[model samples]
Target: MKIITLIRGTIRELAAKATLYVLAGISTLMLLAAALAVGADSTPDGKTITFFGKQASPPVTNEMLADLAGKLEAGFAGGLFLGIVVFGVFGTAGVIPDALEKGTVDLYLSKPIARWQLLLGKYFGSVAVIFLNIIYFIGGLWLIVGLKVGVWNGRFLLSALLLTYVFASLYSVVTFFGVLSRNMAIAIIAGILYLLLVAGPLDSRQAGLYLISENGIYRGILDGLFYIFPQIPAMESGAMHIIAGEHAEAAPYAQSFLSSGGILALSAWILHKKDF
Candidate 1:
């Protein structure tokens, strides 16, 4: 079987499902809020909304763009991760076991192809669906940021790339577990727990992005749990740093793009050696 054909078929199967309701709602809210802030200063009309110490008609500048981008990135990632960590519980819930239970896995297994190709084809197909959705998600974010500032950040585009990579990393692990149980529910639960309860704690350890706000208790848990979830994408932090302008003094999006490629390669390797 052609890998491209198989990958395309799986993605088409998933595309027919109505997954846009969530994206539509999220886009609407983000756009509305961003527009209000950018064009109207948070007050839709004649209402006087406070802007800290800044005057009513604040001057637009790159510094202001950086500040807004940081806040937006923080909120976007926080909410996006929260949604993934929760809804991922049912995202690919029945992919594996259902197919295997229905004997579909056997059918695929019977094909005159290598196990690696079969596993890789399935992984790529599922990942393709994920990739499209994440791109649309980033589009929503950029539309809002652009409308608000009358200028789009190069950082937003770069972050979009990283966000997609992170999604792939999280879902790749989920796919691995899904293959193990051939059960959808189990795989989703495994992924969610890893992303939420495991990944966060693991990275904020002894060598974490230590700071004052996070506190020691949080840092200790973060450090201890870093390696437990190997699928944790380093791009998650790198994206945030870029939007916050923290990377201004360092290499330009160097860390994020490199991390993205690393996660993709890691996921591909995992799928290549996978039994299913």
Candidate 2:
């Protein structure tokens, strides 16, 4: 019950700060643009695609609509995933650091709540904020594409959950760094650098690294780091596969989930032991 109260309080605090409005405004604009830009006309023989009423080159056959729809869905899902990750990180990075401020921590600790519970509540409150925006943005996009493009791909909706999980995974790193350094800038930079540099580049260049280095120790360390960090690239690829209605591997999701769990647990432990 205390945790629930803390979660609600966090949500209310965030809402009061207009974070929800900012995110929702961006989502609404995207949906509006999609609605205005996309159009489809169907006949007995085939379908004609249009952008702003200009006919797309080479009319699409009825048989190709499914393939085209799948591609469109995947493309939109990918864009949303990227946007949410970037924006979610920037928006919520301050959550933990702000909570850990001198007076704020003192006031929070004065309550009957356990330190871990307080940290978990703040963590989940941030997640809930992102979750709601994901639903709003993804759901609005789904509706726009379904109604305008004449393709109601249900699989695209699942991307919302997958994207939320991805954010949660990355946000765990932000939370860890936030707890460690008590600096919002550090938290934000850690999440962004991990996404852009560590996760994407390292995952893609693993084979190249192995080729460049003959040292067994180097190779072993590389492989160990690969398993230690959240498997973001693999998980992202799996998300795209799922969006495209293909079989997605489970290992990436499992690896990421475990790494994120471990990181969050460590953050909570650190918070518990920290001198307020």
Candidate 3:
């Protein structure tokens, strides 16, 4: 009964702002559409506005344009802006530590709820809002691209969903980190630094120099270090294919299950033994 109430109430709160939350995606698609109308790909590279390397440069079609738009959106808009911008900045990093720092757990844990249940519930609540925003955003983009280009891209829809799920999984891991710290700024900083160590290039132009080296030994060291973090780009291959209006076979579903399951396990393991 308690779990049911928690899930229901949490979902209700998130659903209240579903439309407002989705605006990010809607705004992005509109901008892409306008860019399409005005020849967004007419740059020096000519990769976007392709003319088959022919004279007079053939007119741009929607299929070709949609393909270009989907690719850029998957990597840039979907990955960096939506995943990093909204989820990282507004959702996970903001919510978790804020809840703990403000002593919101006192109110939550008082309800005969186990600490793990409380943590899981909180994770679900925040994730719901972010999920609605991303999935619909990417799904709508695919629909728009298909209409403009006269190509069916159902696979793109699936890829977009899978990618968002992976992002959500990463956010869950970060959220648990925030909860462990119980200080908003501290948690965010920790997450940033931890991710830098886990995922950022070991060999860089700056301070991460300890991670950089041209020697085979250094390369081996870097590979060993980075193998710990889940490879997000591999999960992105399906979306890359959707840009081409075809589906590519990959292990995204299996990867998502493992990563998300790992996050849930870690969060539970930590919350179980730690004092609130």
Candidate 4:
């Protein structure tokens, strides 16, 4: 019951914020507009309108439509996944620190609940908000694409689960920083920095750098960090593979699970050890 109350409170606070509303509105508009554009990808006229008016790029076939839909769905899912993580940092960054506020922490600690339960509840509650928003937004996109392209690929729906996992993993870091720093801005900034560093360069630029580096120590250091942090782009690629109806390796899922477990475990440990 205490956990439930904490979860409800976290959600209510987020609901009262304008950031969530603005993000939802923008995501909905983008997905809806993209669905409409994809619906018109191929017309009966056997021509597509370009800057120079209708031109015969080629006649669209079922195979082309399927391929295009797969690519668009993957791209759209990836965009939503990244958006969820970025906006979620802003949305839920204060949850832990707010709970840990002077009077607030006292009130919570007086309860019969264990400290770990309180922290985990708060973490899961924040994750629940992200999960709901992503599911609602991406599920709508999946339906729209199915209706528009006449390709009912159920695998695309798996992107929502993958994305929610990504957010959960990233937000665990937010929770950790929120508890450690007790400052919302610092918490949010830390999560964003991690996202920018790990999610961006770690995939392409760092991989190439590691490949060309002759220094054994340098390569080892890079490799260690590479495997330590959650490889978000790789996970996103798995989601894309599911969307494209291709066989995806299980390594990404395993990595995300391990990363999330490690982060949340560390968070719990810190919260348990820290003084209110």
Candidate 5:
């Protein structure tokens, strides 16, 4: 019951944000366009290009349609991922810090919930928002692709799971910063920096750095950072595997799960000891 209350409260706070609504509106528009395109029988051959019932040249085969669907799914994945990191981080990064604000902290502490429960509840609730949003976006695309192409790609739906895991992993970092700093700007900046360093070149460039850096301490530090941060590249590869209908190894997913769990545990511990 305590966790439910926190979930409801966090969801309500997210819904109150303008960013959520704007993003939702954009997703809805895309879904609408996709729906329209699905039903328009522009050509009996299924060869013509379509846009909201508008027909274009170039006859396409079922194979072509399947390939198009796959490519579209991949492109959507890339865009949705960027949106998830940007809008998702900025949208909910403040939930923990806001809860910890002066008067707000007092009220929550007075409640019957345990500190860990409250923190975990909020964490799960934020992830829930992302889950629902992804469902809406990907669900629409899945249906549109299936209906238009006459091929239901089960892989598309499965990609949602991998993508959600990715978002949740990143959100754990955002939550940690929010809990530690209790400042929205600091939390947001930290989350962005984390992505730029851990997910960006720093992850891939480590190998070359190790080869060039003669200093043992510098090499050690690079190796340490590499192992410390969640293996985002591995998770991303897993996502691609889902899209491509290939078997993905469990190691990357497992690594990301353990890392995310570790971060959440650390956040909960910090919140437990923290005083308003």
Candidate 6:
């Protein structure tokens, strides 16, 4: 009951700030633009596609249509994956630091709830915020593309869950830094930098780095760091594969899930021991 209350309070607090409204507005605009810009006509022969009322090309064959649908879904999924990661991190980065504020922490600690419960509430609450927006954005896109373009790609909807998982993993880092630093900027920066610099570059360049480096010690260290961080690129490519209706590797997602769980546990332990 206490955790549920906290989650509700967190949602109400964030909603009051217009965060949810702003995200929803962006989603609505995207959906509206897609509806206006994308059009298709199917005749007895083939299908014709248009953008902004301008014909994209001559009528395309059924095979071409299938290829186009796969590319379209994959493109949207990739773009949304990146967009959600950036905006989601910025949106929820302040939750922990704000909660750690002097009077705020005092009020929360005064309750009979355990510290881990408090942390979990904040963590889940922030995730809930992003989860709602993700569904809105991805679901809107799915509907628009399916209804307007005559392409019903059910696998595309999986991007919503994939995007949420990525954000949750990233948020664990944000929450850990927020609790440790009690500064929103540090928390936000840490999450973004980890995504851009650490996880992204390492995952992309790991093979090349291993090939170039002769030092066994250096290679071992790189391998250790590789396993330590979330395999975002792998997860991303896996998501693309899934969106394209192909088989995706499961190891990256599994490793990322474990890494996120470990980080969250560490954050809870730190919060439990820290003096308010």
> CA lDDT of each candidate?
0.56, 0.83, 0.55, 0.77, 0.79, 0.82
Ranking by lDDT: 2, 6, 5, 4, 1, 3
What lDDT is obtained when candidate 3 is compared to the true structure? 0.55
**TM-score of structure candidate 4:** 0.87
Please report the candidate that would top lDDT against the real structure. Answer: 2
Give per-model TM-scores: 0.69, 0.93, 0.67, 0.87, 0.86, 0.92
> What are the per-residue Cα lDDT tens digits for candidate 2 across 52-99?
888763467755775676777677777777777777777888889999
- The runs of at least 3 residues in candidate 3 whose Cα sits more than 4 Å from the true structure, single-residue gaps closed, are 1-4, 11-88, 101-103, 193-197, 202-221, 241-256
| Cα-based RMSD of candidate 3 | 6.1
Q: Name model 1 segments beyond 4 Å from true.
A: 19-25, 28-62, 207-228, 231-234, 248-276
The residue ranges of model 5 lying beyond 4 angstroms of the native Cα positions read 33-64, 206-221
Clashes of each: 10, 0, 1, 0, 1, 0
- Model 5 scores worst on lDDT over the 10 consecutive residues at 37-46
Error of 1 at 138 (Å): 1.6
Candidate 4 shows a clash count of: 0
Clashes of 3: 1
lDDT of 5 by residue, 1-276 (tens): 889889988898898889877777878887887777653243666665466666643567766766656666777777788888888888888888998899998998898888888888888888888888888898888888777756678788888878888888888888889989999888889888888866665566656666776888987787677666676666776787677666778876787788889998999899999877
Clashing pairs in 2: none
- Give per-residue CA lDDT, model 1, range 24-55, as digits (tens): 45656755655556432433332221233344
Candidate 4 local lDDT, 88-175, one digit each (tens): 7788898899988999999988989888888888988888888888887878887887776576667777777877887787887788
- Please give the lDDT score at residue 205 for candidate 3: 19
Over 4 Å off in model 2, which ranges? Answer: 18-20, 61-63
